[model samples]
Target: MMTDAGEQLEVQLDDCPPGRETFNDPLQEDASGPDSHLSSALRELEEPLLLLADVALAPPCGRAVFYSCPEAERVERSLQSVQLQLHFLLSKADDLHDCLLGGQGHVEREALAAAISSLLYTCQPYFNHLESTARSTMAQYTHVPADMCSTLLDFSQQLCDKLEQLVLTYASYGLLSLNEAEPDSASHFCVGQTQLGQLKLTIFRYCQPTPYLSRANTQLYKRMRWNVERVRDQQQTEEEDGDDEEETFTDYYFLCYEDIPNPHAEANEDSEGVSDGSVVRMWSIGQWVQANPDPSTEDIWDWILCEVPQGGYNRLLFLGHDEPSSRSATDYLQQLLLSCCTD
Candidate 1:
């Protein structure tokens, strides 16, 4: 037993197709008593009651739906549903304002704003998605009233502000934890990029600590570059003369480090120019083996342990080139030295 306006409002609120029940009767009442009869009547009157309140409350029972949702995911889903309902309601109102009232689509502005604000507040966990959704939906309306458009734009801006604040909070906490973990590690780590001909080369340098030995500090360097070169020759004349060659490319990796200066060089003056302290100590950790001239068909790099030159051996350099993998460069270097000693 619904009025014409009630039926119209119900039809507008029903986003589902024809013959589908939009609401479920959760409280089944018995006709045995007066209280039961009253409860059943109230249940039947719910839709009409919401329709009557829609004009004043805007999104009829959206607040109740939002607050009833317990979890974050459920709250977000409910908010989305409410937003869709509001959008449909606004569209219907706009049609009525243009066709029946013969006026600007201004009546639904308050309702639309209220729905947007409720969604923004309720779906805090999905703020990022909310901003995108609002922007996309707002873009779809080419003839929306000025007031409604302004409201939507304002809500979108608010969402952006909230998201930016959250990102700053996360970044601050991450930086604080990083500082606490290693205060001075940033000073030792360095990265640079340079152009080697047409190719780009990246250089990484860092200080590696040797805790067990007195000569405990060394500088580690890694260079990475890509190379394109000739891999094959089709003709015997081209192969011998290096004229016509097939080209191929591959990534090149080089690992090397600064060698610790000879500590006993200061004590022994006879050590070759040792007291001068002007000599540079550099050690290459990997060797290049030209198994094939063609770059595409061969493994050109080999890793090996270099023997320390004779007569300068204060202690044989034990470089750990093997250990459990880690993201830490210093720890990896120590593990490499430990591996060399064990082997």
Candidate 2:
């Protein structure tokens, strides 16, 4: 009783996958009507259809996939942006590594300059003296060829310009503390013939408050002295009561040991037991506190470089105060440097 078209539909329904039987499907007639199961099937198959469409649109060389969904496209763009930044960092690090290696290799100035110029795209954005420092380091080698020095100087000048730009950029970002430009990279050459040293130019992002400066006064000095005496008294009292053993405390000292050339030699006026002369001067932190409760204000960072006496190791005291802004502290450092030079 079925017509040709009806017969074809019947045959297709009979061949339908098991459990997906269309013969008794309540939504079969609705395929072209409301709540159509056919529509639901088409919606589920949309991703596959898109994939086929992409393949058809792709070039013969290769295929690129794209999502038409707006949210998906936005996420893809964000991911690409992150990837680009990461690549930039990797390239910058590689350039720095190459520069360090080139210095070690004793490469010619022109070559170093080329490498630096290539990498300047990244370094000049963050560091102001990168090129000058690199050039200074290269020029410091006494063995450097004469012909290359001029080229190196040119490179150094260019580097300085780039560095200035970088510093200004960082300053705009509230990075550097001081606005004044530093001494030319040439100053590093003061230690001629010594292996070139590297100094990192650092920029702090925020201004920090200075540490508390302990003011020196007669009363405070006396108090600290008394505190030291009290500690000794407590130790003595404990010993007298036999409640504890003597406790050792830390103090900075310059220790010198005389080596005896002949241990068996008898003591005599000239011989003095036949020994090598050794002398050590001991300095105590208590003495400093007693002398100046408050030291002068100077850059304590530079003060630490003062020389130690007698061509021997010097012991510097920190007194639990890592930061020093006191005038007396600067005086103490000057004293050490003067004594060392005198000795």
Candidate 3:
């Protein structure tokens, strides 16, 4: 996806200097001493710093570890950023609790709760994605060095635990949803934890590489997980005799127009309207359906991928394939178009 020049730029960007650490806050320093109880408590509360050395440099387990890669290191840095942000907000939460309990007005307390909720909401998706990627990466490891796989799982488990605590704390303070029906708890957290556990279980069940995919075998189990529509289709097909569906088409039309600026325009707004290059692709799908109410099965694929071009726009279709399972049908559609283009 990247050109040689682009790759060189990426390498240069990666070589940029690391910024100074801001872990120490002079204002938060205790007057007593480093050994003071307050200072010690604050130090203990510092967030977890994900270190690549801690994860990858340890004794080798029988199974391979995913953290040996540079990409994994970048992931670790991102995780550390999230952890640090969580800790920062947690300290604020503690302050707000103290302020509210000290008879602060409802408005201020409500605002603090809102702040906490916003921060936690922002974190949910990032951590969820991170955990998902980690699970998928671990699945690729065949003979996971016993030391590597278990240690990596342990790191993932720790991250999950930290996120869970933060979510529960925010919920307790009325800043987050504790609803079982909500995606945060029921969908995201549950699925993430389950996936992480499955990763560990894969390594556990299969001391060595095995063909079978269980919660234990990363590749087999993870890949086999079907999407909702596919599952539903399977269920329906099983109930019936898996009869093929017929296709139909009908005609549809829309008014065509060239770029014409609207009469009403604000001073700051551009009055030129859409560019002349802009084109609208129109097709009579309804007419096509009416023309062939029961078209041949073989024609469907072609019909879908067929391109319909108009003045300025074009429409192309793509078919989904099951493979290493990286990109979706939509992602491949762009590539398909590029492939058809003149060099």
Worst 10 residues of 2 by lDDT: 186-195
Quote the lDDT for 19 in model 2: 34
Give one digit per residue, the lDDT tens place, for model 2 in 1-343: 1133233433333234433233222111111111233323222222321222222232234444344577355434433432333334344444444444455443432333333222322222212221222222333332232333333234333333433343333334333322212321110110001112222111111012211112312211111110011123456859667656544332222111122245454445346633333322222223222112123435564446533211122224433323222223323433443454468
Candidate 2 ranges with C-alpha deviation above 4 Å: 1-68, 102-343
Q: Residue 114 in model 1: shift from native, Å?
A: 38
Write model 3 residue lDDT over 9-56, tens digit each, in one string. 233222322221211211111111122322222233222222322344
Query: In model 2, what are the clashing residue pairs, if there are any?
Result: 128-163, 216-293, 216-294, 295-326, 295-327, 295-328, 296-326, 296-327, 296-328
lDDT of 1 by residue, 1-343 (tens): 3234334444433332222133221111110111232223223323321221222212243333222234334434434443443343344434423332232344443233222222222222122222222222222322222333344334433433332233233224331111212421211111212222223322222223222112323254322111212233358647667767544333333244444565545554545644555334553333222322333433434212212111111222333443211112222332333464368
lDDT of candidate 3 at residue 197, scale 0 to 100: 20
Pairs clashing within candidate 1: 319-337, 320-336, 320-337, 321-336
Off by over 4 Å in 1: 1-245, 249-255, 260-264, 267-280, 283-287, 290-343
> Candidate 1 clash total?
4
Question: Evaluated with TM-score, which candidate comes out highest?
Answer: 3
TM-score for each model:
0.18, 0.18, 0.29
- The segments of candidate 3 whose C-alpha lies over 4 angstroms from its true place after superposition are 1-103, 141-343
Candidate 3, residue 12: the lDDT equals: 27
